[model samples]
Target: MDFWNRNRAKLAEKRRLRAARLQKKSNPSSAAEYQEKCKEASRTYNAKRLLAFKKREKRAEAAEVKHGRKEANRRQDQRETARDYKVEYELMKSGAEDAFRERVMHAMWNPAPGEYRIQFSDGSYKYFD
Candidate 1:
């Protein structure tokens, strides 16, 4: 109980000092100074925030440009691949036709006795009457 009483007095003294400090800060001159400090702090904070926003926007634009280039390259690669495949198919088809023509010419030029060449629908040749 004695300790509590002693502490209570100390608490009251501390409260008085805090109140006096608050009262001093609430004076017109001190209030103006405090407002100016607050304004300066707010300005700095807003400037920092604006700079960060601009940096983020720049990064986003760069990323979009990079993505666009990548997409264009991908499309170009696909087109090239398709063109290559078409050319390969055409070359293979021409080679097959040439081979078939050569075989027919050879058969016509060298006919055996009572043997004739017959062509099937599946691009095959057989010996028949």
Candidate 2:
């Protein structure tokens, strides 16, 4: 078995050498042609790779936009839901809230910019500006 393996390896090596010699026998022009062919093949491969990458990028961009739109819609929906809840709460608390507003509005006064005064229910007075 060892001999057989060694002999097989030798045969493969000889074949490889023979193929190399055959390739080296080409004239300079043929060599240049071979190089040009290799370059063209490489160019074609690179172009295909670039096209695939661009396609992936386009898909990614589209997904991002779709996700962004969904997020925007979600945020808007949340805001609307919150507003609806706020309206319901306000309607339930309308009398108390309105009374509080009136009391606060009557108690507090803004005489000027950055100036305010608060009036207590008592007759006592304090000045602030």
Candidate 3:
């Protein structure tokens, strides 16, 4: 397989292995049990997201009332800026770029970028971003 397919396969295998390891501790006897666990996870994740959004809205409104909507928005924007900065930190790592790279495209104009390896005389290769 080519690099992109190989990389995707590696990632998929890693996910499967991790899932197997995790599931061993909480083995559900049936598919229905697994489905229930998945639904509960989805529900919990959504509830947390909703709570966060509500908190941000309240903070924004409070800021608007005390100061001005512009300042409130600016503050909220700063928080988002910080969050994005943390998310982008992965880009600094050579291996982490693959996680952020857009892999799913309806129009396959080109294959995704691959980390090309430079091989030395002794058959050892150096990985580069």
Candidate 4:
């Protein structure tokens, strides 16, 4: 068993050395080829980055759209609230003014023109007459 393990380790080391030698036997490339490979890698990296950026931008746009809709709805609700308040204010003002006018009319019931008098229903003349 010890010998088998030693042989296995040696075989693995030899295989690794042979693979390294094969890599060392590769053909050399020109500067132009190296630059072209660099450019290709850069292009691939930039394409991936651009795709991620576009996805992020799309998500941001969708969020903005949702926020815009929410804001629009909120503004609409505010407007409706303001309109209702205005209507209620107008109604209250009109009712108060009507009551004031009625009171004024009741207090100024002189039978003759330009005479601030008070003639009772019993035909009695008061001090205001």
Candidate 5:
């Protein structure tokens, strides 16, 4: 064999010997000691798993509360918008905000063929031929 091959084989042998020595040193000698080690490892794993579950649950609760508030606020805004459009624009006497706004948008963007829509700075609009 070449010199390089011989050196490589020696290095591999040294590594194998080192691994064997480490395994022998760490090998548990007593049954009670082994059982203690296993129990400790199990306890550590269970604690970590419990901690992770708690964190996940806490995050879910926070997201639910945040999304719940958002939904409530959105509903309130829609009701207020519907009320204001009824009062301010004198557009319709009664309708949901969604329908009212859709009607307004359709009128604004797609007026009659010859009619033009104009928006003033004060939020009022007019239709003219």
Candidate 6:
């Protein structure tokens, strides 16, 4: 059994080597053609990869610009809110003490259900229902 197995293995190896030699002699141009095709494929793959990278960079730049614009707008909105609050505070400080007290009393006396008084920067009160 061991002798038969060794003989079979040697026969298979000789058959494989013979087949390889036959194939190499039969198709000599196939190797060069394969290498040319591989080079072309690699070139196209690199071109596509570079294009994708550029597109990704462009998108990232646009996103950064968009984020910057949004941040600027947010800062502008915060500044406007602060300015409005400052103006309201100044108006409240500049008004006479008696007038302020009278307005508060008037609002308290006219308290309506489900309505709240909103004081404006101009020292005027309005009911928010």
- Angstrom error at residue 121, model 2: 43
Cα RMSDs of all predictions? Answer: 14.5, 12.7, 29.9, 18.2, 8.4, 11.5
Model 6, poorest ten-residue lDDT window? 101-110
Q: Which residue pairs collide, candidate 5?
A: none
How far is 29's C-alpha from truth in model 6 (Å)?
Answer: 0.8
Alpha-carbon runs more than 4 Å astray in model 2 = 1-14, 95-129
Candidate 5 residue-wise lDDT, 34-126, digit = tens: 568889999999999999999999999999999999999999998986675545344433435465555564334335785546353446675
| lDDT tens readout by residue for model 3, 1-129 | 999999999999999988876786567565567678889999999999999999999999897787886788899998985574455444424345455343211111123375444333334443434
Q: Considering TM-score, where higher is better, how would the candidates rank from best to worst? A: 1, 6, 2, 5, 4, 3
Please report the TM-score between candidate 3 and the true structure. 0.33
After superposition, the stretches of candidate 5 with alpha carbons farther than 4 Å from their true spots are 1-29, 91-129
Q: Quickly count the clashes in candidate 6.
A: 0
What CA RMSD would candidate 6 show? Answer: 11.5
lDDT of 1 by residue, 11-85 (tens): 999999899779768798877887899999999999999999999999999999999999999999989866744
Q: Sort by lDDT, best first: what order?
A: 6, 1, 5, 2, 4, 3
- List the pairs of residues colliding in candidate 3: none
**What is the per-residue lDDT of model 2 for residues 9-86, given as tens digits with 9 covering 90 to 100?**
999999998887578566677677778988999999999999999999999999999999999999999898667445
Error of 6 at 5 (Å): 28
- By TM-score, how accurate is candidate 4? 0.42
lDDT of each: 0.70, 0.68, 0.62, 0.64, 0.69, 0.71
TM-score to native of every candidate shown: 0.57, 0.55, 0.33, 0.42, 0.52, 0.56
Among all windows of 10 consecutive residues in model 4, the one with the lowest summed lDDT is 100-109
| Model 6 misplacement above 4 A | 1-26, 96-129
Whichever of 3 and 4 has more lDDT, that candidate is 4
